[model samples]
Target: MEQDPITLIISLAGGILSFLLLMRFALQLSQADYYNPISQSVVRLTQPIVGPLQRVLRPKGRFDFATLIVALAVKAIAILVLIKMSPMFASAGGSISPLHLLIFSLAGTLNTLLTIYFWATLGAVIISWIAPDSYHPAPQLLLQLSEPLFALARKVIPPIGGLDLSPILIFLLIQIVQGYLSALVVI
Candidate 1:
């Protein structure tokens, strides 16, 4: 399996950027504290791409459509660039159609969202074991991100023995969704 080093580098860089961009999109969607160090850094890192996209795309209420679009674009462009850099990649799989590419990018974005939630849930669970304080930005953000899911779980499972089992249920649910998304068809 011969892999082009350049393509690997480019794809990894694009993936990281898209992940960060999607994080900003999620944070905004969840109404996270914008003044926090993480939120501010995400905004600054992605401002260059998202700033112009916002002018053209316009946002829909709290959701940043431009940021979402930018995240998808990053994935799409990375795949296209990889194909271009290594024509062998195309020959191995046949030509990738535009519609196929779009679906592929969207699936990737969905997978990324699932991944973000998985980490957020994990962090929130860990913090609850230590100190779940609102004064700290990271734990607050994790709690903010995971609370809705936890709420849903509580509605279904409820607490037991004065212990919050919402996190466990949330993890199970996240894993189920992750499995489904991973199996999602792009064709």
Candidate 2:
């Protein structure tokens, strides 16, 4: 079914905004320094949402998973709302059940998050290779963000001949998960 322009625009906007918000939250949760322009921008954009949640959740020490929860919740709500209202704004033909919409939004969110991670990792690898001694904030942030993912991947698939195949494996896994979730939404 073809989506209406208005609905398509709204959905796209919501998806992008939510992706940015979630990435900012993830960076903060990972304790990435706010010294770079990108980091500063993320902080400024996310403070309105994170500030209040931090006050309420008050994570005891270095671990603050609440921010992740809040970000995900906000993203999910925004996506769901956009999907729910899409028919009103756009001339879509297919009947989107609540369950289908929910599944689609959730899967889309996850897909976006993983894509962000992939990009960040790519950036870090590039920066590290080009200027090993460069004091760039993005590389550091990327390193911090990709560590856990890389670690998990390494555990499952060890490096071969000094080349890390973990990322490729993980990417394939993410693609499978995305495909499965997308199928749920359509079926």
Q: Write down the lDDT of every candidate, Cα atoms only.
A: 0.82, 0.68
For candidate 1, the clash count comes to 0
What is candidate 2's lDDT per residue for 68-143, written digit by digit as tens? 6665565566666565565554566434666655665566666677677778767766775787566667667787
**Worst lDDT 10-window in candidate 2:** 178-187
Candidate 2 overall lDDT versus native: 0.68
Tell me the tens digit of each residue's lDDT in model 1 across 1-187: 8667886789789889989999999898888888988889999999998999899988787799999999998988887777666676756664578987888788878888878988998998899879966578889888887777778889998999989888787778767876776764221
Q: Residue 125 error for model 2, in Å?
A: 3.5
Model 2 residue runs over 4 Å out of place are: 1-5, 60-66, 88-104, 184-187
- Report, for all candidates in order, the number of backbone clashes: 0, 0
> Which residue ranges in model 1 land beyond 4 Å of their true spot?
86-94, 183-187
